[model samples]
Target: MQLRIKPYNKNAFPLKALLIKGDSVRHWVSEIHALGLSLSEVDAYPVPGSSANTVFGCFVLLHSNKKLSDLRMHEQFQSVRDLLFIPSFSTLFPAMSEQELRKLFSSSKYFIHPETGLVELPEPIDWSELLIVPVEKCREIEKPQDAVFIPRNVDRFQIKAMPPEDALQEMEDQVFPKKKEFEDKPLNLFEKGKLLFYKLLFTGKEGKQGMFDGSDIKMPAWLSKLWPGFGGTWFDKMQEDFADLEERNKRKVDKLMEMLENDPEEALRYAIPIDPEGRGRGQIGNAALDFFTRRSNFSLFGTDGRSGSGYAVDLGDAMYDLQRQYIKTAEELKRKGDYEKAAFVYMKLLKNYVKAAETLEEGHKYNEAASIYLKHANNKTKAAQCYEKGNMTMEAIELYKELEANEKVGDLYLTINHRKEANIYFEKVATAHIDCARFLKASIVYRSKMNDPEAAQSVLLKGWRAHRDGNNCLRCYFDNIADTKELGREINAIYKNDVSEANVDNFLDVIRHEYKKKNELAENIREIAYEIIAARSQSDPSIVVTLKNFNENDKELLKDAVRFKLNNKGK
Candidate 1:
């Protein structure tokens, strides 16, 4: 009837089901595991695959009966709501589905098994550190409609159901019954409304807490699918939590606000955790930091933008941290379609980037900036806003291009793929780039990435349009240029038409003539020397040529240092 299932580390959580001799449990365990839960051992009975016909059932993990988190998670076990979790399954067993087991191979929460569920797998444990880190959510996920190989959230990818609106509504409807079994309804309508409201928001159907409450409630997928506690989601209790955190933080902020008048040192001294509503990563605190910095600056110096010793200066660490967080959060927000906030946060990063770019080169400073931009691209709508702030956006995109971070840059492009604005800026940047390989790559991307060859060619043409259409000044400097003859004719035509810059052909002709003369001088040295002597002074470079010719008859000139031999080597 009750079970306790807890593991100190990632060890197996044994399963033991207390049932009659004919309880028919094996098929049941297999089904639950198939749905994605971990299973280890079972008590006295054989329940691995008991049923031949049945497809699914719960894996039974027993730990000295049942703990509250476990019991509350099940169908009708409500008695142990107050018990603390302990890991002794002497009379009970640990139960999990095959899917869960495969995803989390070891019964440990630290490493998730591949076939398991969707929570992002956390990094490995550091032996040097004692604390355990939670797994990160996987960026790679797919919905039913998405191509099997492609990640979800493309233009064609539909949204996955997370607690479909219907579930929330159905639970809501139950609160206001036509006629309740109880005689007393409420002392006041407002009170009744308040009670119903709290119930609807905090608990799911059958009084299930919609969140983790330090309890071991292994929520079934059926229920969790309805109340998704995934990344960046706002649950029913979020507002209430925001309210309470806000109240405590409010006084600190007010003090911080006042501190803005005189001491920013004191303002930052207020410490992190300033805003409760601010999830660990966000721009909320940056706004607070900006407020503090501006107030301090204004109070110290006149509003004319002059600084004095009296001005309160913040190290601006808070701003930096908040931006870093926002850089991460903004991307997440975009993915979730909280576009307004995501866009606003991205704008915040752009402003910071401007400030950062002032102190460092755009290329180097963009390293950090681009990371934030990456998350921005995870959601296209947010990227559209950032894309407009020319400098920051261009800098961000340049870094993305250099890295060839396709998953990111490609997706960002998807957002702006159809926009004229996107086309214009991309063309400008593509044209500025010297690598034709970049053009070729973009060409390849058209076919492979978004599956649009027209887009690829358009991108390539923009990149190579100027280079391919004309001979380069550098290339014309070389005599080996193949189009010299044609180019010269073009030059003559241009000259006849009174052109400003010389035509490519004329440049090539000059280069070619120089090469021709050099070749003749090398082959007909005597003639060149004769001509030189006839036209020039008593002794010139021609004299040297004559000496070299005479040297052929001197054996000494051929000796060691010379090609001619000495008297002993006279040949």
Candidate 2:
């Protein structure tokens, strides 16, 4: 007899099942009875003969308000040969929009048949494929509640439940079964030596062994072999030894801390080992230094002098000591001909400018010394001196100019026989000083070294205009000239076109004064004097009265002047 089965509807029942199509329906009924679930507990539907051609059978556990993809399967049920499972759907489509649900059903590879109102796959699926609708597509369906499902207790029907003791035995057999007993292996020579070394290093009483624990202690393979077994006793002994050494170090640090409360400097001395031998046993010293240097609070000795706890030493004091040590180390490096290293320590660590510069200078490192002096010490003069000593003449000149030491700058140029450079600096000074002496020096340099008399004359001209006493400058110009006749001719040419009578008068006065100082011949002086008067008479007719007034002093001046005037007479 053939039984007609309708499509399963998830909304009509909480649980549903798909009947496996077989040769006889009685076989399936017996199998279901053999399992714990009864036929009434599940809503089973018969698979048509065409859909049951394969061994795989699909059973979908659906929820009214959830998607099949949302349900989580137990690990054991994740894959099965005959049972093709689909999870509940509420997690996939909880509160999904209506438009999204319509779009999902329209485009999904798995969809509910319109006629049957039942979900269907694209084709018949194998159980081993673990086929289900795609999670992403399922998430588009609209649902009101989260996806959930009651897991079936398949283990009760699939296999016999073992007793508690039998389960424990089975786990033990898989993980840690007993092994056959064997005799102990003998130790090799290297292993024996290692064991012996460890025993000797760790097994001794606290004060009995030498204080080599903190040093480069290692097990050597060449040591004599004297041990029997590698056991736990050695580790215990080593731990005890470490504890005792730690306690000793703690006591020493505490003692140093106490002394720091009273005499910090004395405590600092103990904190840094002085003797070479004491350096090897500096564990306590290092600890004490660290303890004081840190920011945490430390307890004092008793309540007599201090009641509250504070730092054993302030940061300032600690840094001061550290700086002193650094300076000492730098000095030692300097003494040992390690000047570069010493300078680094002085500059970077100690920040001692004087010492750093001195050390650099001692090593003939003048460039670095100049930099340190100029930048750190703010001593431009010293920096220039260093540059000069190093033969960095241009650098020294620049530095001297920065200091505005124009005289020193000129002197420096002169020392190097750089007369042109000297003249440059002298010109700057002359411009600043506006003195005849400075201009004279510049002119001398221009004449002697540069061999440019035109430049020298220009300098003199500038000096004459700059200085208040032009007469001194005029005398300097006269002294610079080689011939008195040429000097007279030059002076006549200079005053020939003088529009100002005062300027001509000043020129005459300068010539007269210069002549008086040298006691030059009267005729020579009269020649220059008459040339100026004759030129002045042409420009201004009033010079005759001045000439007459000048003739009153000497009768030779009048005769010579009359003859000079008559020689220049024209039609």
Best by lDDT, which number? 2
How do the residues 443-541 of candidate 1 rate in per-residue lDDT, one tens digit apiece? 444445545555654554444334342233223222222354553443344334422233323323333343344442233333433343333323222
The whole-model lDDT of each prediction reads: 0.35, 0.49
Q: What is the C-alpha lDDT profile of model 2 across 456-495, one tens digit per residue? A: 7777766665543455656677777777777766666555
TM-score of each: 0.17, 0.31
Compared with the true structure, model 2 gives a TM-score of 0.31
Report the error of model 1 at residue 198, Å: 57
The runs of at least 3 residues in candidate 2 whose Cα sits more than 4 Å from the true structure, single-residue gaps closed, are 1-287, 291-342, 370-388, 392-445, 462-469, 491-509, 516-523, 526-571
Tell me how many residue pairs clash in candidate 1: 53
